[model samples]
Target: MLRYILHKLALIVPTVIGITIASFAFIRLLPGDPILAMAGQHGITPERYEILKEQYGFNQPVWVQYFDYVWGVLQGDFGISVATKRPVLTEFLTLFPATVELALVAMIIAVAMGIPAGIFAAVKRGSWFDQLTMGVALTGYSMPIFWWGLLLIIFFSGYLGWTPVSGRIALNFFLKPITGFMTIDSLLYGNWPAFVSALRYLILPSIALATIPLAVIARQTRSAMLEVLGEEYVRTARAKGLSPRRVVGLHAFRNALIPVVTTIGLQIGTLMAGAILTETIFSWPGIGKWMIDSISKRDYVVVQSGLLLIALIVMAVNLIVDVLYAVINPRIRVQ
Candidate 1:
């Protein structure tokens, strides 16, 4: 396992490099000069702009810039933000926690709702409960995330006044920042108002992010459970006078969990990707919002560094999923 993990870790460097290169090229090929965009052309002469370019090493060839950028990243220098002139990493570290919190809550919602629905559907196959649950899953799978987010905001926020419309939490309580994740900080400090406020703020976005995954997990879990329940071992367990719940829950569900675990693991990657739309709709200050803003402003450093960071995180999650699969099913490692 250690060998496998080490091998996977070795791939991170090249994967990050490739992501950096591709992102750099994409941003470079984008129209407009970074320096000109930053300094503005209104009152600047060609000479002054050239000086600015030299100062920022913009006069260097693209390859040189790319090499220097990679080296700078290696040395922990993500470069100054054109928009705010702050270190790009510093800015991201602050906003990333909210996105992670949203994703975590979404995963919890997906598992809590999906697994039970799946188990019940499998046990009561072809009944009214199964049909109704499957129909709801279908609806969940089809709904667009952004549309769902807006609808949630409208119903829960506008009509019912039950949830906050946008942002991470109520601004008034002002919980102390710890690790930048409001939920964790609120709970850690035992601040009931802040904790409740943070949770309320999270509900809409979490549901929005979890909806599709919940449906997918439910369907997969149902299928997996049905297959396991029909297996010879399940029949044997039942024939041995074991309780129905034990036969299903202990024998069938454990085997069924392998696939469900895979689905949940893969769901993390999707949650992060989905956060882009969910964050935008909810005006949540996360990596997604930051990426959108940086791209619009053509902040190359911020964009490239952020692409690397997010890609790295996604890769790390994928690796964790692989390790989990091996643990849950030893056949993987035996090979």
Candidate 2:
């Protein structure tokens, strides 16, 4: 188990390096000059532009820039965000927890509802529940996130007027951000109003973000459950007079969870990235929205650093998922 974990951890270094190189190249190749974008309506003279380039080291060869960037990254420096004039790492860290909170809430909703819906659907097979759940899952999987989010806003926020349309918490609360997660910080500060406000603000976006993952989890769970239900162990459990519930829950569900967990784990990265669209639609303040804003301004440092960090996050999630295989099935640990 230790060796397996070490091996997986070792793999992340090269993966992150590759991601950095690709991200660096892509950001540099993007249309528009960061310097001009920063200059805004105050156009610079040719001499001024050249001075600015030299000042920001834009005049350096691409390879030298890349090497400097990598060296800085190695020393835990992600450079300054041209948009905020703050350290890219600090900016990311500040915004990241909100994304984590949103993603976690979304994942919780997906797993809580999806897995059981799938189990029931599999158990019933040809019943109405199965049909309804599968149909919903299919719709969810096929639906575009932006349209779904807007429709939800129209119905829930506009027509029904039940929830806020945007932001992490009500502006009135003004809870100082300790963890960057509104809900957690609210609890820490003993702010019930803020906590409730955060949850209300969170509902629409979390649902929007969760839609695809829920559909995927439900479908994967149903498939895995169906396969496991047909296995010899399940049949033996049933033959030995195990109750239907025990046979399904204890024998089948446990076996089926491997793939479901994998889907959930893999979805973490997608959820984080997908938060960009959802956050934009809902006006949620998170790294995704921040990145989008940075992209619009052609803030090269922020974009490159953000992509590299996101890639690192994805790789880390994958590593954690790999470790979970040992817990899900002892056979993996043995191997």
Candidate 3:
């Protein structure tokens, strides 16, 4: 297991390096210059432009710039935000946990809702419950996130006025960034008002984010369960006088989980990247929101850093799935 993990992690290093190179190159190659982007070059002089370039090391050769970027990364320097003038890493770190918390909440809802619906559908193959659950799942799968967010805002926030319209918390709640997750941090600090506010705000975005993945996971889990529930072991468990529930739950569900877990983990990575649209709609302060802001402003440093962080997250999730597979299936254990 250790050997397999080490080998997988080693592969991730070069993958991240490649991602870093590609991100750096692509952001630099975008239509506008970062200096012009920051300076808003309406009436800039040559001397001033040169000074900005020299100051930001934009005048450095391509090779030198690459080395500098990489070396700065190695030393934990992700550079200052070209837009905000804040340290990119610090700025990102401040907001990243919120994204992670949101993603986790969405994943929880996805798994909780998807897996049971899937199992029930598989268990009753062609019943009313099956049809209803699958239909709902399909509708969820088809709903566009932005449209869904708007609908949620219109009904839940606009008409009902039961929840806050936008943002991570209500105006009256005092924020204490304990773990950077507003909900969790609020709880830790004994701030019930903030906790409730954060949770209520969390629901619409979490549900919207969960839509496609919940459907995908439900479908995959149903298929995998359908196949596994008919396997010889499941039949044997039934023949040995095991309850139908045990046969399905213990024998079939366990094996079916491998693929479902894989889908869930992959979906997690997608949520991390895809949250940009969702965050924008809801005005959430997360990595997604920051990435969008950086892009609009052409903040090269923040853009590059944010992209690299996303790449790292995707790779890290894959690595976690790989390790989990080895742990669950024993056959993949390193000799």
Highest-scoring model, lDDT: 2
- Candidate 2 or 1, higher lDDT: 2
Task: TM-score each candidate.
Answer: 0.92, 0.97, 0.94
Q: What is the alpha-carbon lDDT of model 2 when measured against the actual structure?
A: 0.91
Candidate 1 global CA lDDT score: 0.88
Model 1, position 199, has a per-residue lDDT of 85
lDDT of the candidates, in the order given:
0.88, 0.91, 0.87
Q: Point out where model 1 deviates above 4 Å.
A: 10-14, 40-43
Worst 10 residues of 1 by lDDT: 35-44
- Deviation from native of the Cα of residue 5 in model 3, angstroms: 0.5
Local accuracy of candidate 3 as per-residue lDDT tens digits, 1-335 = 78899999898888888998999888878787878878774757889989988988889998898889889988989998877888998998899898988889988988998999999999999999999988988998888888998999999999999877779988887776778989888988888878888899999999888888899899999999999988988888989999998988888999998898899888977787659888999998899998988887878888888899788878888999988988889887844
Better of 2 and 3 by lDDT: 2
- Residue pairs of candidate 1 with colliding backbone atoms: none
TM-score of 3: 0.94
Residue-level lDDT of model 2, residues 1-335, one tens digit each, is: 88889877887788888988998998887799999998899887889889978876789999999999999999999989776789999989988898999999999999999999999999999999999999999999999999999999999999999999998888788877888889888999998988999999999999999999999999999999999999998999999998999999999999898899899998998798789999999999899999999999999899999998998888888888888888778898777
Better of 1 and 2 by TM-score: 2
Candidate 1 local Cα displacement, residue 50, angstroms: 2.5
